[model samples]
Target: MTRCRAWLYTIICFALAGLVTGCWDGVELQRRAVVLMMAIDPAPDHPDWVVVSVQIARPQRAQPPSTGGSGSTSGGNKEDRPIAVVSREGRDVAEALQTIQLAINRVLFFGHLQALVIHEQVARRGLAAVLNPVAQSRVVRRQIWMFVSRERAEQVVNALPVLDVIPGMHFTNLFRNQIILRRQYDATIGGFRQRLVTPGVEPYLLGIDGMDPRLSAPRIVGLAVFADDRLVGWLPGDDYVGWALADSQFPRLDLTIPCPHGHGQFVVNVTRVRSRLRVMNPDAPRPKAVLHVHVHGMIEGGPCVQKEREADIQVLSRQVQQVLAKIIGQSIQKAQHLGTDVFGIGRQVYRMHPSAWHGDAAWRQTFPRLRVIVQVTTRLDYMQTYRQSALLYVDHEG
Candidate 1:
């Protein structure tokens, strides 16, 4: 009976295999519309209408870009490459997207879309209209990073060598590395919206500008500053770092400070960092915040004073603390002067003093005038030395 059952099962397995075949319903790469990146900007000569740039992968011509190289690789003459650039006009974002569909040959799909860049002109108008379509689209991935371009979206798309085929993939990788390395601004679309619509905190996007129009590919120059949904201005990369650190997004920082004793300058590499936010007098006429930051770091390279004693460590730690304190103060003052709350202090206030926030017009007026006390504590944990020692001086002859 066992032998008969085994033979019968074998026969059934073969019959099932004969009836089934893999990929019977799969769509081939050539048949589907593969989108790479998207760029949206205000239409030329008309603020009401907008232009959309769509980049698609050309799999037949080249392999995907290797780990570290320029994104666009030319498979053929620049103009002859089979890519789509569609411009559509509509009062609303959905209408414009639909119009783009009609303009393109293949059905437009955005599941693989890499980045969504907004032009400064449209971002300045406000992002409510722009975000409506993104939120409703099932094809749009939530993780797609967003940026604000100082140049028109059309220019950013067209000014490419069409190298890697998937421009969005390249752009996303660039921003992701910056975020992980804690070097650039943190303004992903999801995070930006969270900060923008979450009651009090506003949002800002990285302001991008083309490096050289004549070059084959363009690069970013600066970051865009926003107040709520309006584009306020642009901040250079270095100034933007301070804001990133204050926002708790920058995990590691290596800053150089000029020390007269060190001839050149001292390079401090921050190894460990902790920050605490305190709300003081939440219900009072004036609200205060204490940004208590404790950082542990070591001097990587600089002029040596030839001392490695406890007293020397104390003096070095105090000096580094003072430098960090001044930098944080300047950054906070600059953001306040611009009337931008990139730090989300407003949300902090709402969380701590819910009752006081009710019908509080004064908070809005006072937000630009709020006070922040920044305290920096630096500790030098290690020194590349054998024994605890002080500076050695040669004996003088009488």
Candidate 2:
């Protein structure tokens, strides 16, 4: 009986402890101003300083049912409450953020930050000064998306979309949309910082800019290439497409390539892209990189000669393969010219032959001289009934 009673008491104690479980230092949600996004730009008139801007979400209070409200549309003055974007200048990101905290009424909360925007000038200067402080933060999540804006980071954080008023939702929508479309490159802080410490492979981020001068909306496009922690150059449309395709980031990409006959243009909606980059003779004075990309897509649309029987898709596939090789090859060359190894070819060399791989300085020296051979295999899942157009084909013309 004594033993049974002791066990019962212990069980009761455990039950009480379970009931007492709660955050010991929890703060009420209303007391904290949630930061939606943050931006870093060069401070005006302070070449050595950085301006950090954070967009804080304004929470609307629920009002009681309008007492005999005369068909009023808005719930209240809620629409007037804009996402408060405030900036503070300091020697570095952490100091700037600390200053902002002192000025704000509520404690600045970053547990739910959506994005981090860095200006073009800031990127060119180098990201180490800005990112080091951010990486040290305990609350800031690394999975949040990162972008480099061509415009001032201030403009990106301040601009409000008429269609989407929920602060930072436009960025979220654009980012996720790109993923869904499988057309553009995307970057997250966690992945990028990992590459910072990673061997051989450099880092890249998605870019944002006012694609049109007339529009206030920011468009996500292209890529910001970085050599180690410093921004080197950017890859434009075609180059970005090539990088995305070769890096296995794009599951679907639409391409308009010349027909096999080389006279007219045709289209193919490419999908299931897979790329493998291999480095041969890593120990030699100069190494060779062979990039093999295998893709499967359908002949989407284009000017094609309607053959009496189904056209030869093998020829069409071969043409597509060549075109892809050219596209990917050009992108690789651009990266080499920029002196940034955007492709993980260097990483492969290090992994395949660790002893052969020297330090970064040695690798960078060999990279530009390295010749990359791009081989693409395009398989048409199925072709349309149409094929070669004799009238459109110019066998004898350039």
Candidate 3:
């Protein structure tokens, strides 16, 4: 009898729990505006004020058919845009967002935010103040891609994406695909914050440039070097290419090696690359860092200057290694000149020799003067399809 009474009590509790489990604190999706991309720019007139622009995805509603016999719909077409951009200014990011909320009828939600873009001017000034509110906000996710735009941040945010209906999605896909296909660096807000506060290392953001001035199509160009939290300068063109080779997590790169015969360049499609950095003599006034890079690739296309002999392939490999070492050396020099440790060499030093790290202050002073040595080893394992170039045979007969 006691057991039966206990079971009845449990049943009653379960029924009451179900009654209270409905959407008590839920907002309707249609009534809320979802922010997909956000941009922060310093106000031209007032340096104290910051202009924030947001690209909000508008709800898509089906359009009714045309009244006339024409097949086209009245309200919907391929030309219709699925997003709306709004801008507001305030002393801080939070205040600016609040002002935007007051102007719009719907509540603004950042849970869907995909990208964060800052104008070059704003980035050069500093990101601490701008990123503070965003880092603290529960709605903003840490994984969003961050960029420093050469053009106004608003222009990148407002630019229409050609491939996708939503601009933010396009940007996300573009960055992710580039990392896989081109082996570019991946920079996110979370990674940036950790690097900013962590000792022995600094942070960087991908530099974006407007490809077409009229269309305002933005493209990832290079990297923006930051000393502490302030942007120092840019790593452009081949300069960035060198950095990417050293720092990429998955290094698949392309190299144009000058032919040994001095005719033209051959393309080497590097499928795999690995980099290892070692610190020597940490107690010395100037510590030395040795970076060893191992690369394995195949010759894609070039004038076939080499005979089919194994000796010829070995010689070609040595030439490729020399070129790669020179490129990596140049990249390291550029970072050293900027007085920024983009390679995280200081972090390696801290881990290997903790006694050497006095603190953040001491590491910064030592990093600029430190010596770096780059060594590259390359192997051409196979000559795809062709054993020897047709040109080699033609030249032999001549």
Q: Give me the candidate number with maximum TM-score.
A: 3
Quality of model 2 by C-alpha lDDT: 0.75
Q: Tens digits of per-residue lDDT for model 1 on 1-398?
A: 99999999999999999998888956666566677767787876776777766776555644442332554444445444545556667776787878877776667667787677788888878887688787567767666777788777776555444344455554566556555234232466666666666765667776677645333444565456667777776656555655555566556667686664556677777766666677677666666777766666667767743467766665566666666666666666666677676666777778877876653344546666677877676666546732222221111110
Which residue pairs of candidate 2 clash?
Answer: none
Clashes of 2: 0
lDDT comparison, 2 vs 3, better candidate: 3
The lowest-lDDT stretch of 10 consecutive residues in candidate 1 is 389-398
TM-score ranking, high to low:
3, 2, 1
lDDT of each: 0.64, 0.75, 0.76
Compared with the true structure, what per-residue lDDT tens digits does model 3 show for residues 89-157?
998788999999999998888888998999898898899888987878787888888999998889888
RMSD of each candidate relative to the true structure: 8.4, 6.1, 7.2
Q: Which residues of candidate 1, in runs, are more than 4 Å off?
A: 1-31, 64-76, 79-83, 159-165, 180-186, 212-223, 260-262, 304-307, 359-362, 385-398
Q: Flag regions of model 3 displaced more than 4 Å.
A: 2-8, 11-24, 61-79, 180-186, 212-216, 248-250, 304-306, 384-398
lDDT of 3 at 350: 83
Q: TM-score for each prediction?
A: 0.78, 0.84, 0.86
Error of 1 at 85 (Å): 3.2
How far off is residue 185 in model 1, in Å?
12
- What does candidate 2 score on TM? 0.84
> What is the TM-score (0 to 1) of candidate 3?
0.86
